[model samples]
Target chain A: MSYVVGVDAGGTSTRALAVAPDGVVLGTGRSGGANPNSNPPEKAAGHVETAIREALGALEPASANACVIGMAGTAKLTDPQVAALFSAVWERLGLTGVRIVTDPEVAFASATPAPDGTVLVAGTGSIAARIRGRRMVSTAGGYGWLLGDEGSAFWLGREAVRRALDELSGTGRLGELTRSVLAAADVDAADRSLAWRRLITVVNGEAPVRLARFAPLVSAAEDAAPILDRAARLLAELAFAARDPGESTPLVLVGSVLAGPVGARVREKLDGLDVRSSTDGVLGAVRLAGIEAFGEDFATVPGDLPRVP
Target chain B: MSYVVGVDAGGTSTRALAVAPDGVVLGTGRSGGANPNSNPPEKAAGHVETAIREALGALEPASANACVIGMAGTAKLTDPQVAALFSAVWERLGLTGVRIVTDPEVAFASATPAPDGTVLVAGTGSIAARIRGRRMVSTAGGYGWLLGDEGSAFWLGREAVRRALDELSGTGRLGELTRSVLAAADVDAADRSLAWRRLITVVNGEAPVRLARFAPLVSAAEDAAPILDRAARLLAELAFAARDPGESTPLVLVGSVLAGPVGARVREKLDGLDVRSSTDGVLGAVRLAGIEAFGEDFATVPGDLPRVP
Candidate 1:
């Protein structure tokens, strides 16, 4: 019985699935982070190998005809060292024809069977990619927090701090959002002048991307509608930037920010387009591997490609 | 023989000027950086003392009845340790009645004799200060590079890199600004895909504020007009935010960004207002010290205050 193995390699964790050619789930496995950018290349590759090994389970690894890895930081593989590390993992696992693709490509594939579409991811950072032939061909606004990352969780958290500072700068009453922000930063609001200064210091004291921790507070506050609206608008603009003019294709919205209020607003802004939400990228990886093993018609196999929940 | 001393203590250098009651420049001194936030408190205080002693020039430090220091990062002095160091500098110099104020206050005083006005500073960071009674009472957008600092040199440089990334993300023609950004980042434009990725990596590899180094490139490129215009708009908004509605007091523009093309655009946006440029903050320090020593009317003393060049 021929089978295919698929893995979704993320920053914090990695997951793998092995499936028979007939779309039967053979086994599953999970491991630690495998993103080469944040994790050491050897460790990342080791995690990928571990997950795939577990997924193979009692099934013969040599029986898998194809393997696909949907990785968050696939760009890191451009480095020869990292590429070699990942290659070594495949060799040790006795896996051949291993294909590695960006998480966005898998995300788009997970949402729809369309070969061409747009995938917008707004997790800690944000980026929009144009997918053609189930692959990310180009991207927009993935410049990280320093450059862009507009509409990202990082952007949302930074905006929350800016709002708190703005409220503290004036004599007006502090809004609920400001109060929540001050509380989150563990800064006392008794002295407005000192509060703002302290808040700035606290935010700058940590890693810049850690600012994403404040993002959840934004959505929970009643006075944070403007921030949410702006985030949605920026995210929609980013999605459109990655698409061709008037090109109507499935737009897959992935990431935590898109799963809540901001995502709803983004959907409102993109009223005309066919929008889909993809939560699990591993399923997408499985679908891609299945297609590679069973040809294009495998995409239409109902039991083979699971629906994105 | 009762002269007043004024010092402008900045991040890169410190300058001191001794002025007579009638506004005649007595002696001048210059030294290294004295910003407590960037330099050690002891070193910063020592630099301030060195500059002031040189300005006293063969005269008794006790002869100066009043001394005013216009310092960048005056907030750093709020820390007890830093304040103690500065106090020690005053005592060692045998200087009494020493007063320290923010750079914006002195910049406002340098531009005009008005007791109330606005001061906009846009160097590596950006801020707008509201001056009342010759002191900064309130401010806008001085939240540092992490939170705000909109329209700052850092903001301009960051926008330049973003523009380059945008151009590289698409297959369209690269603009002059994009080419210049690529060159400045030392990224080879041979492969558009590799160039944009390389540019982002190069930027992330450095200190966040170092992005300000690219500000000059934005001004030098003709295609960078949109970025300049947006920066001007943001700065104008910041200046207006610091002023009360219909308040017609003088608006003093300070810092290197305000001395260049971005400054020109900001001035144009701020048209119909009382606009002034203040290049020498030390002169303002002298003017303030003269006022504190002689009387409020001393502001009009022609010989006691030199024109801002």
Candidate 2:
């Protein structure tokens, strides 16, 4: 009869899962983005509430023993005003003892039962975190699109664009990658200067994060090995930087960029570590809730909760 | 009656120099920042005009045979609206046929008389350009602070902060770099967690480009050699990427990051190449104007011009 709720408040969408003590997913609900960094605090909180309410769905929200939110940019909560807004939402939901952790923590937990490990994420942005138990204790290379985020989708895409620009400017050899990027940017001119100028204009017109949109194209390119090599190396370096010299722990690879060739390359580079992939962040949140509700630090993930891999 | 004008429209300030056909320094002018990327288009244009007006002093602005304005983010002028705004300002200033070039081009021309060469700039942002016939024909690694700008002041500063965070988390060795970065961020907390959290908050509060403010601290740190090594290596790679092997041309180093230890390292990396430092961009502009006015590519830089270096 008792239940716990797990939430994944991401930049693009918010998702919630209601799970029983045994880890059975009772219900699932979704809502708009709930990232405080991207959305207004009130709106972000509202979306979180909406998703949780729908997941609860007459299951008595007050009956839920605990709630854990796996959120992107949880650092926004460091601001008192933003934290208070989120707290008010929890109060209205009739939930207490709510726990919030960074997306990387949930991801690391989702991949393995290990309490301490490393998690490398490479979606729109890239970051690597060292997880201690269920908490992200340290991190490396999460400097965002502006500063670092090397080996991220953003970096991959930016590299692809740079290659295309070089080709258009007579500095790079013409290749299939160059042709595809030029066409994608709708630059038909054979005149390199004109095409180069147009391409720059095209990129600058969009939002900075949208650079990730071109990343998949690199994966599709015939000459993607170089980019993949650099990405994997950088990601591995980040994980290594977050770990002690002799330390050995499970490394959880998460996010879209890592799920493809880049992930394989990272796995190959990190030969000594026990490598795993996070299939679903929601499952990790559910496990955390299980730990909270039953005080089962070593509880095995429920067999019938759907396979993670 | 024939004269030339050269201007450096930078993000912090604008400077202009009037040079007669015989290399006589006629007048000079200074004004606020005129970088379109940093200022409103109108304000950017106004600053440019003010600098030029002051440089003209007693000389008729229309009497100049050629005017060259070197500006940052020249790609922004690819936008028709922004270009039109700048054009209007040029018309009002009676600057007929004002020539605008990328900042790297001016930096290269300032360093050497070679019309074709490579320029490496490592200020808050980093970029390498291949200059052909006094024009920027190709470029590498100018993706701005968001995507790349490797080996720049911003990169050094961001790396220092990252190293500090690692040390605070016990994942890295506590060293001079870590201690310096911690103190610089004003993270006086004995608790590593508190200090880590506070540094993130402080960095996020400022304009991302301002991260360059912490770069100088890294230079002062005892363990700055590795950073300098990496920076110099990356810069050399950028320049090489834009140069054809076996083709020898002057390599010009410019900006604060490259003016110090990093610059020495870069110089050491390119020992066989003709590497020189760009002391004044306005001097480059003056040379370009000379080429335009006299159709002579080989004009000596004026000796009596106020010391630019």
Candidate 3:
């Protein structure tokens, strides 16, 4: 059986999976911090290699024909500087061949079995993309915490902190969600200023992923407010913009944040739009690599990638 | 000469200027912090009274005619609770009639001597207003630093801090404005993170005006960048929105930041638009009170308030 590898590289962590021709998981691997934007190109590639090695070690005999890495900075993969670094690493690893794409592209491919559709990804960052008749069109937001990332985890997290500070200072008109989120986060009146300031610093400086991690807490407390309504509207706009108005295609929802209430809110906002939540992107990456490496109908094959033992 | 009192109630301090119908400055007063949103109505009113008393004390004998206070919390001035406190304070100080308007209106009047014109004020906060004939239209912003005050000193200061952080972290590819502003502010590499974070925290929290005071430094360092371009565009949009397109009226620029190079940038962006800058809002407040107290044909009389002694 032919083998393939799929990698999802993130800000603080990277997850890699090895799979067979029949779409069955063969092995898994993990590593720390692989975002190229955050580290040197060599260091980023090293992180990916570490993840691949760990995933391969899990298998008795590594059966990997080709590898596809879905990374955060793959949007710049085609750049001469970035491509040279990645190519050097791939060659050093003695891999047969490797394909690279942005993390969102892989997530979109994995979300739907269909070749042509749309995927709305909302995570530490947000982007919407449509794969229409072999061409991809996309819109990205959450460039960082500073600019406009409207409905992003960082945005919500920062808002929660700001609202808490406002409440403590008596300048804010408290809403139920803001109060509860602050309470659940254990921010009190005395330390509210300090905690809120720290949260803002975290959002502006270090890991914005930490803010996305609080998505559940913030979503659980969200009530019917203009702020939430505006977010919902923005999500719907992203979804609709990624979809073809003239053609009918399945709309898939990917990303962890989109798997829960935020997705539910998005779907509610879409109302009549065709959409579904995707289970896994790595699996989709494997299928995509198989189709590109083999043929278009490869996903139809069964028991392709069995767990190696 | 008919007497009038104009108060500029700021976040950290309050200042009152008593003027005569002839536009002659009579007296001036100063007091401490008094924002109704943060302090009780009684406390805020007491602060206002202290400021007024100081100005009244400068006069040989305080002229009693009419009073107009250009205050920060005039939006809530009409509220019964706040109104009652002001009324009690006015009676206690032997001041009879008083009219309250937002600080924006005062700035607008002060910026433009013409009875009908527009003023864009960008201080710690930002707001734009136009007086066409007898009607006034306005847009208020910069309540909190999180949402932003686009063209204000707060925005410029916070942006400087953000760019400095970006440069320190090696994440910025844009311009040198951030680095220059940081160096100008005397924040070094060792203290960069803390200093940057502190600036953002202070701007967002207790004293937004303090950070706003750094806007000129940012303006001095600003070059051609998308961020600065957007800021200029926002000012143009605000200016145009404040006035009717059919009518031709001078657009006055107020606030410390707007009086600098940033205002020139805004003016360039608004090429062909009638815009100019004014030195201070107190002057406009004096002019507006004169027009309201006397007839529209009142000459260029000196402000009536007793001069500071």
Best by TM-score: 1
Report the C-alpha lDDT of model 3 over B1-309, residue by residue, as the tens digit.
457666767666777777766666677888876667667777888888998898787453335566666667665665788888888988888876677777666666655556677777776767676666523543433334554466777777666655554454333353567656556555544554455444343434544346665566676664635556666777677667566766577777877767666777898976786677764445555556566677575425533333333
Each candidate structure's count of clashing pairs: 3, 0, 27
Of 1 and 3, which scores higher on TM-score?
1
| TM-score, per-candidate, Cα-based | 0.97, 0.83, 0.54
lDDT of 2 by residue, A1-309 (tens): 898888888887888889888777788888989989999988899999998988898898778988889998787898899999988998898898899978898787677877888898889888788888778877776766765678888888888888887677664567888788888878875788778767777887887778888888888898878988998899999888777787788888999999888988999998888999996777778778878897775246642476422
Best candidate per lDDT, number?
1
Spell out the clash pairs found in candidate 1: B22-B304, B23-B303, B23-B304
Q: Which of 1 and 2 is ahead in TM-score?
A: 1
Task: Give every prediction's interface RMSD.
Answer: 0.6, 2.9, 9.8
Residue A65 accuracy (lDDT) in model 1: 86
List model 3 lDDT by residue over A131-232, tens digit each.
Answer: 764235544332344434557666666556555544543334666765665565555435544545444434435344565555555666655344455556
Better-scoring candidate (DockQ), 1 or 2: 1
Correct interface contacts retained, every candidate:
1.00, 0.36, 0.00
Alpha carbon deviation, residue A58, candidate 1 (Å): 2.0
DockQ each: 0.93, 0.37, 0.05
lDDT by residue (tens digit), candidate 1, B192-217:
99898899999999999999999999
Please tell me how candidate 3 rates in CAPRI terms: incorrect
Which ten-residue region of model 3 chain B has the weakest summed lDDT? B299-308
In model 1, the Cα lDDT at residue A261 comes to: 93
| lDDT to native, each model | 0.90, 0.82, 0.63
